[model samples]
Target: MNGTSDVPDRPRRQCPGCMRTLVVDEQNFHKDSLCADGFTRRCSDCRNEAERIRYSLEAPQRARAKRERRAERRAYFESIGRYEAA
Candidate 1:
């Protein structure tokens, strides 16, 4: 023996989000963020979809937050008598 372990390789995994059979390899899986496993649970396509949906749902809130921040900055400048009316 060349000193390699005799354990069999793991079988392919099914993506929980898409139900697609996938080979968990460097080319397919991403580094897991939750630290439960070494690879991500969902496939790339599923991950992208999830991100897209999340952004779409939160877009309005994000835009509103940005506008509020800008308004607050303008108010602060005005209070300091440095803001010019436009």
Candidate 2:
């Protein structure tokens, strides 16, 4: 008789961030993350953040707008002699 038959079957997966063992069908398997439907495994947090950033309006454009607003404010302050150089 072969002893290999006694071994139970275990799902195989690897974490995207750490490349660690990620058991399939487990709670940590596909909770949240951008993972390929095929064989790729990605951490939940990483995936969620990516999705959030992608869908959020606070992207690089927002940052640029903020910078422009600040520049406008600084120019106003300078014109009023309220700007102090440190």
Candidate 3:
């Protein structure tokens, strides 16, 4: 028999968010240009869940920030002598 182990040397990565060992591929992970390997650290499932939680928990703050930005833009436009209706 050959000395080589039966297990194939497949690319694999652990999802830090979920602690799941998933194959490193486009189907199991999302691509991110900023990452070292051009893929997100968390698997797609975990990433989606994190996004869902973050959006829900920060909804109020997010809305407030959006409103503040809009107000600032309106003020800037008015300062430039281009008044806009709210």
The candidate that wins on lDDT is 3
Best by TM-score: 1
Superposed by TM-score, candidate 2 places the C-alpha of residue 45 at a distance from the truth, in angstroms, of: 13
The TM-scores, one per candidate, come to 0.73, 0.36, 0.64
| Clashing pairs for predicted structure model 3, backbone only | none
Give the alpha carbon lDDT tens digit for every residue of 1-86 in model 2: 86568777877677667677766654555543555553336655556667797868568788899999999999999999999989
Lowest lDDT 10-residue stretch of candidate 3: 1-10
Better of 1 and 2 by lDDT: 1
Candidate 1 lDDT for residue 62: 100
lDDT at position 66, candidate 2: 90
16-86, model 3: which lDDT tens digit per residue?
A: 98899999989989999999998999999998988999989999999999999999998999999899676
Candidate 3, superposed: residue stretches over 4 Å from native:
1-9, 33-36, 84-86
Report the C-alpha displacement of residue 33, candidate 3, in angstroms: 4.4
Counted clashes in each candidate structure: 0, 1, 0
lDDT of each: 0.85, 0.70, 0.93
Clashes of 2: 1
Error of 2 at 65 (Å): 0.4
